[model samples]
Target: MGRNTRKRRTPLATKIVAGAAALAVGGGGLVWANFYASAHEDHGGHNRTRSAGAQVATIDCPDVGQKIRDVPDRARGEVDGELATMDSQITDAYQRLATTRRAQAGDSQFVQNSILGPLKDRRKAIIDRIQLEINRAGGRADDNLDELAGCQGRPADQQQDGGGQNGGGQDDGQNGGDQNQDDNGNGVAGPVADDFIDINDVQPNSRNSRNGLAADGDGGSTGTFTTDCGVNENNLFNSDNLIAAPGVDNGAHHTHDYVGNQDNDAFSSDEDLANADTSCQNQGDKSTYYWPVLRLQDGTQEFDANDQGGGAEGNIGKILKPAQAELKFVGSQQGDVVAMPKFLRIITGDAKSFTNGDANANTSWSCSGFEDRQVTDKYPLCPEGSQVLRTTNFQSCWDGQNIDSANHRDHMAFVQEDGSCPEGFQAVPQLQVRLAYDIPTPTVENGQVQNPYAVDSFPEQLHKPITDHNDFINVMDENLMNEVVDCINRGEDCQ
Candidate 1:
């Protein structure tokens, strides 16, 4: 079909324009590619212009992965260290407990002959050392655990910038910010963390919940004696004996287990016996047995027999005289002495006259005879013959004559015009004149004697004679019982 539309010779202008346009487009495309490459390079080979929602290609960093991996190892090491410290602390506590137990035993010294003293000391030392170690280890373990817990992985952004002052962020890394801010917009500091680890936190067998250390068993310590045993503080601390000497036995004839020389004995002293010893047989025996006599309110004279006789009587009252001007007499022995039933009332005239016609003669006296005798056919016109009637009889009694050799017959009594007590004499229990029989020999051991009688039995022939009438009246007073009880409780010697 050769419609050769005469191939018009192409216009040089159009062809040149078309060629230039093609060249321009190719150059522009090349410039765009270069710009893209340059942008990617600027952004560390990342798409700088990518939208937030666009999918991104991931790139791995060998250094970062290694750093992340090292974190767990560090944490594990910390935990191991903490465990080691805990073990050390537990061991120390056990050691200390053992040591304390040992030392305490030695220190107590319950038995003086025991060889456990050294062991006790060693135990104490060990306990002290263990306590110190536990304290140190506990603190260390606590710190290490806290550090490990705080080092848990933080958000990637927070890690890059170093975690906030309080470690992870305010929102717990959900949102990064200061977490310690108060409602007033003021920043508050974190809690003061505990530095010491409690054993209870980790160990199931911890003794932290146990009570304080047990008390020492032996009562060697003064503290224990007072607090535990209720012993008197003075007795425990000063080493004083709680049991004083068993004083004189009055009001009964009894034997003492611990006997000593009757002289200067603490239990047998006249003063001590009167005050402390309540048991005396011849409590009111002024002529023979001597004791401190006290005047009671009812016009009666009372004395503690226990004060007069040592270990012969238990704590009890012994009345001496019954009424005024009443005289009592004993046998004609050296130790025989008359007991006055009551205090005497001196009268004037022939009643006070002397037999030898001497105005001041001691012959005219109220006398107690050994036995009531009638004016006998053998001796008429003679005054009643008292056992100590004549001076000869008096001398014989003083010389310890044919009376029972076992009795204390050396005691004698005489009338004095002035009614003055003998030299070195004080008011004592009025004496009882009796026939001397068998007097037990003093045991004399450890400077004292023990009482042979049971504590409950009363002795024989021991009478509570009333010398002062006023004392008799007061004894029946309603408040007398209360007073006696009070005196006894107060440690007052009540005769």
Candidate 2:
């Protein structure tokens, strides 16, 4: 009697309903667990990505950019080192030359010696090479500096983001309540927003104020937020836009008259100025301009013929005459001295009637004439105690005396008006003229010769004459030899 119902068992419909409800609850739990696992996996998978992001952030540091931008300055230091080395070499050469001159002062063999020719030539070549290298290095440094300056600012296109949220629901004040569900019946959060990140903040490799994220739950939600962590403004790798520090302008070539003058005249033929302008254009400087001859010496004046008071054809002599005349006139009138013109030109309408003296008389004087009277065997003797004497036995004579064979002569002047040899038609070696008169003995110092004459020390003029061509070639060879030796010692490329 306890209930015929218990004996009869539960109805089939009721059992089926209970089983279905249990299955639905279990399925909901499984889905929740899967969602949690997915979130965790996403975080774990992003470890490498986060690490990369951090590295990029560090490079973005403003200091790193600044450091990279300083490359030109660093290069300049290297150039300075090279220049110092060149300077040392030049100094050594100069000192050696000075010492040699001193040691050879009283020695006849040394005084009239041609030993320093090769060394002199080498010095000039070295100087030219060093100057060229300096110019190249300086130009490179300037270009690099310009590139660095352009990197200082931000990119043209920038964006902002707010992390993983919807654009609505903040005003509802529904704390922890799922007022709205996504397509999958999951609760959705309101929009997350952030402020703009400043460059200073990002300079120290800190996180930027623009952080964003995407999440998938019911439908999907994106999260965006900003942090105050600074940007890496100093990262040279990332900061291609960083500005570089400027360099000091050295005075080299700044005071050269030709360079200054060329800059002033628009019609100047200087190719260097044109090259400079082109370089400026390539650098994207639309407004860049240069003016030449910026400053003039005191008391300097420019005259224009068109001006009313420009005075007397703009002649320099006329302009300076007043001051000069006053001084002369005052001296003559008050100081009992005649004030004569500093310079005078005699004007003769006809050459034949200019003077009463014999025009064709042999007025030319000769040192050899004096020497002949003093020495019997020597056709032309030099003055007593003369260190070097000119000998006519050589190609060209100096003041009627024979040219010295050993001395490096730089220039020669003939006693006669015309530089031609006597009508004998003797073939004169032009090289002898240069070697005897062009180069001068090196200056001597306290009883010692510091720089012994080398094949490379000849004057530039000595290289020109056809007869001296071999000597010139020899000098060049000696220079090349020395340079090759130096290069080998330093482990540098040598030709």
Candidate 3:
């Protein structure tokens, strides 16, 4: 696995949180509608995933397959139509914002989103029907995670909302009270009321607050290269779709980016990567960087058929300007050299989704105006003048030569605790990204509460708690890449 690692070109898609869903799904443009549903046989393990056979391009999650079974054959067509429609509308919203001023609506632009949307009502109805199927399958709608059918590998898709897959180990979906309930045994009466994890509860433990998150806080000679990567307003919604590289775009359970080389994908080559124009300020820098798109939860925007999940979810949001991209390599006390590869593909934070515990949760929730008070996991509603922010850091340690690895991860390792490079690995300028939002909470369902304020994740990450993740495909010029490396080797900080 060390010297013989094969170069597997990994899509930014696979490296997220739990490998269950992200590893199994693929992305593309609007062409997903041409594919068939995923069919499953038994696959075992906590990380169980099924790649489509050479001939089949479909999302294959055994758990989601079970949930799909909940949809009666009679309703399958309708549900597909409904989901497809929602997808089209969501795509259109991003297309509109492609040229318009892109920004998360401010406080005045905020309001609780209603469960009324073409997709929501149908989605909820489908879930109801799915519950009936569960009963027929000898399962209950409110069945605890233990009783849920299929693999329990990835529980991320079920984060906040009460459902069969939430995995919070607390909620029973509907009846008998689970998730967040009082002594009386009823599901938490309201959405934001009991369901939202208090800000104070998770802030002290933020992964972003971890000692090595930024430049080595523990102290060491830091070789750094800083740049203002200019805010990127590209259509990153393609995260779950095919991008970053080519050929495999079908129906992604999640999203990923194909930055730098405009022609990246499963088919991209070194030449193609070296020739693309970048979205960054450096016209000479052809590096392509991408992550999941963050959309505004503006409820005023409405979709057809009362579906809040689609166009109602609002357009794709924007990455702030002054991107302040700093690629610094912290060396040991001796100030040993560490430089990253020019065209490395990096994914930081657990992009794959999971829930039910504090184990795999990677969130640094906090207010924009109050960065020092950053919290973790469940976010408390931001105070009046503040907004929420999500941060991501990509893998930086490099093996010095191979541009990529079979698993996509082994090529680059995170910096060591002492802020030194691993024995065989050098270092690259680290890429850290932060996204901000002013998401409004959801309305009280039926005068009580049900759903939590959720971020729009690609399908596999469906309706989960807000967790931030990102992907980077380094398509920098060979000369610039070497320059950064030289700057580091000389122990100098450069922009």
Candidate 4:
């Protein structure tokens, strides 16, 4: 298949700052609640305070949606609506926290009694509705749903625990990028100095070495199939996530750049997506591909700057269009790939990883010329002549039964270290997305950042790079899916 040529965004001069000048990053003040355990105990009337000099940072709530793994088909709609309500609750709570910083400084328990306590009560009610839906659908609701009700506040002086995951980076920040607390870029919502790292300092192949995920060059399908979906040049943008919050407007709470299917939104149904015109060159493929828009915190507000999913939610700045959006499917190393079921939805990476932990993180950031060195937590500061790259590999193993799951993830699994699907899971063509951007290099110095770049996220997630993610819904006709599998099994690259 012939590929369409695209004009890349003009390059910017990259500035390299010495590591010796790296600032000492303070704690990010994010919460850490468990899916089935309470991170705090409600004390009656008494105020609870942090250590002598500690300050409240952000609220972290155990993601109720991720915890509910057994939603019956009949109850999914109601459950999804309730879950979206919970997200909005958190967003509102975060907004209050950001605005009441002065009160928080005076009263340590202000966040608890005035903010978190109220938020918890609202979430508890929503969780009750979810439980009612599940029981009504003849599914046994988890008894511990109450545990996910309460959210905790993290302190600005307490740091996040470190881990050795593929996408995990030093939680305290590394290399350099000044942390500014003012109302500059996203203000308290983040991309804080700690969220960025100089790409030059990252070790080459560090991700593959840590996760034991290096591909083994053994047998099976060795071919590739590519789809040319223009890089959102049509300006398709929205904050509605039909997969997660169908029928709810602004469900994502963040703006997304869409490239494939034109009819995807909070109200788009399977039929709507199937009948939609696609940006892909092949008319048979109407798959929808999208992810949070990347923006430069240069103070230029885009159209949605005041809209719920944009600046109003702290996703402020001028949105940067991708220089290139490459969508391709590759064969498994250990087996022939099966055709994917149409309308199969897949979400890669955790969009709330800043507060949700790195367990579900699946994104990598790097410079075009230095792809070998990737970081999961920090936005890569690319060098001159190199563009920033965001890459994600979708799950390539299916359950062979369900195209969707309760949590939107249980139906698909990533390949094992040996490149084989888990038992009962079948190998399928892996969808790989690579997005590139060219923008002015951000200036980081003396505890301040000018013109920083960040991915849009939930108000509470703080625009952290670990929260970067991608979404896909395969709307391909049977013929296109079959061709993809055949191309991979035959060792031929087709676009």
lDDT of 4 by residue, 114-224 (tens): 988899899999999899999999999998998888787754223444331112222121211212333332343456565667789999988852222312345878888
In order of appearance, the predictions have TM-scores of 0.13, 0.13, 0.54, 0.85
**Cα lDDT of all candidates, in order?**
0.19, 0.18, 0.39, 0.73
Candidate 3 or 1, higher lDDT: 3
Best by lDDT: 4
Worst 10 residues of 2 by lDDT: 324-333
Task: Show model 2 residue runs off by greater than 4 Å.
Answer: 1-75, 94-103, 106-495
Predicted structure 2: lDDT: 0.18
After superposition, the stretches of candidate 3 with alpha carbons farther than 4 Å from their true spots are: 1-150, 153-211, 217-219, 234-236, 240-246, 254-268, 299-337, 355-363, 438-454, 465-467, 486-493
**What order do you get sorting by TM-score, best first?**
4, 3, 1, 2
Local accuracy of candidate 2 as per-residue lDDT tens digits, 1-495:
000111111111111111111111211110111211221233345643232111100000011111121123224333333333322332233223222322322232331132233333443454344344445655322223222111010010111112211111111112212111110211000000111111222222221111101111222111111111111111101000000111111101111011111121211222322232211111211111110011111112323111111100110001111000000000000111111111111111110110111111111111322322221011111233322112211122222222211111211221122333234322111111001111112222342221111110111100001101111000112332334234423333322
Model 3, position 198: C-alpha lDDT score:
37
Tell me the spans in candidate 4 whose CA falls farther than 4 Å from its real position.
1-53, 156-188, 208-216
Better of 3 and 4 by TM-score: 4
What tens digits encode model 3's per-residue C-alpha lDDT throughout 230-335?
4444543332322222233322333333344454443455566667566656555676665544432222221211122222221112222222323223333334
Clashes of 4: 0
The top-ranked prediction according to TM-score is 4
